[model samples]
Target: MDFSDLNEALASESYDQIGEICDNLMLQAASEGVPFQDEWPYAVHLLGHIYVNDINSARFLWKKIPSGLKSSQPEISAAWKICQKLWTKDYGGVHESLREFDWSSQSQGIIIAFSERYRKRMFELLVSAYSTISIRDATVFLGMNEDDAINYAAVGGWTVEPNSGMLTVKKAAVAVEQKVDPGKLQRLTEYVFHLEH
Candidate 1:
């Protein structure tokens, strides 16, 4: 129950900090000649990686887990299911896995936050990539039912065609101002002048 740094990170919803803390904890345990085995919350560590969409790190963590522990700990295996779905780009599968598994109280908050982030990210991708998308495809991408997808798209300022069931994606205009560093510019000019001379 005493998760130490992990509990602190979770309390602040600082998901990015979880990976570093878990890494340090593992290193500390190893240095102390302590057998971590299943004593550590491997599931939470794996989920932290997944929460940040760090699929490669999550996969690496999964590989590092002992087979015995992986088999014995249902939570660890369940967390890996989400990782596998994410790896395959199976968006619907990710939602399904999240729903199917009964996560512990400690892990539930991160899971919910991860789900919201994933959905928002997918919406941003849709806005940038599509002029129009079918309702069915949008549902799969958002991991929502048809009506829910339609409503969500509408809330995002997308127009849903009743007959066609195609959602018109509203792209937000992004104005990027190029910032030039004066010192860097002067240094570059000096280098160019020297080269020409």
Candidate 2:
């Protein structure tokens, strides 16, 4: 149980790699007919999947966990709660779940990372989808206070109407460009010549 690989993966914040390492470790342990000496890593493994927004894998991992371990460790349950909230598209619940959990040191970093990533993604979605939204809805979506949400919106180049408490979202422009590769074009010409002959 050296855990050097796990430590390195965590240090690099390669969450998908962290999930892979945990998956391999579990498989090896099961093949050897032994249980993990320290079961805490499973919590991190579950969180890693969630951090990457791989809800399907997270659900599978949750189902694979032993019932005793699920009951014994609150962290696992907390992670599952977040998973459930995410699965249901409950943004407010997801933030609340993250805030309510008293995470261990190993799990804390990923939790914070997940929160920021999710918030930024939601903000991007809002900027793309909405021309106008209320401050209250933005706060819930970003898990921030009114002031913070306003500031965040400002940073994103959105305008705030002080009298109406509304944010005027700036929709991002779509860039669609078509470029043909020279190699592919040459290959297509060669194929056409062969067909004609």
Candidate 3:
């Protein structure tokens, strides 16, 4: 399914339907005999970014008010509550690490250091989120095969052998493209959609 569609569903608060769709998607992946844990970090990190950045923006626009609005303002008051909770609880260290990293230089040391910190926290968030759902459910949510899921989870710099971490999403994507079947990835992507479509 498209990210926009998923975001729309989330905005509409159709969580139960979302859960069912995710469940079915996972079942399809399971049938392929792929494990699911690997992709968990990617999914969590993506979701965390969505909830924090995009959702917050939408909530702000929907509220139709400037920063002068009081906390009691109806527009974004509720949303701010949820966003604050997720930020403080779910993705606590990521923003901090991003600030700590020097983004100016394209040095190898800078890249490796940032990636190591980012991936570790991303993995931790993924594991925490995954524990809340069944393997079947997670597969559906990510729309990836069980194997792809595990591969994604097995991501992080430390998870791989030294000098093999790759250290960036672009690099990881290239590696997966080379190693994984394009057709399989497409199918997995499609599977993440709600069957109702």
Q: Which candidate tops TM-score?
A: 1
TM-scores of all candidate predictions against the true structure: 0.85, 0.85, 0.21
The candidates, ranked best first by lDDT, are: 1, 2, 3
List candidate 2 stretches off by more than 4 Å.
Answer: 37-40, 176-197
Cα lDDT for residue 85, candidate 3: 38
Q: Could you give candidate 1's per-residue lDDT for residues 1-197 as a string of tens digits?
A: 34677898999888877877897888888888887876888898998889878889888888899999999999999999999999999988998888898899988888888889899999998999999999999998898999999999999999988899899999898899999999999999999999999
- Evaluate model 2: give its TM-score: 0.85
Ranked by lDDT, the better of candidates 1 and 3 is 1
Rank all candidate structures by their TM-score, best first, as comma-separated numbers: 1, 2, 3
* Model 1 TM-score on a 0 to 1 scale: 0.85
Give RMSD (Å) of candidate 1 vs. truth: 7.0
Model with the higher lDDT, candidate 2 or 3: 2
Listed per model in order, the count of residue pairs whose N, CA or C atoms clash below 3 Å is 0, 0, 13
Predicted candidate 3, C-alpha RMSD: 22.4
lDDT of each: 0.89, 0.87, 0.40
| Best-fitting candidate, scored by lDDT | 1
lDDT of 3 at 184: 95
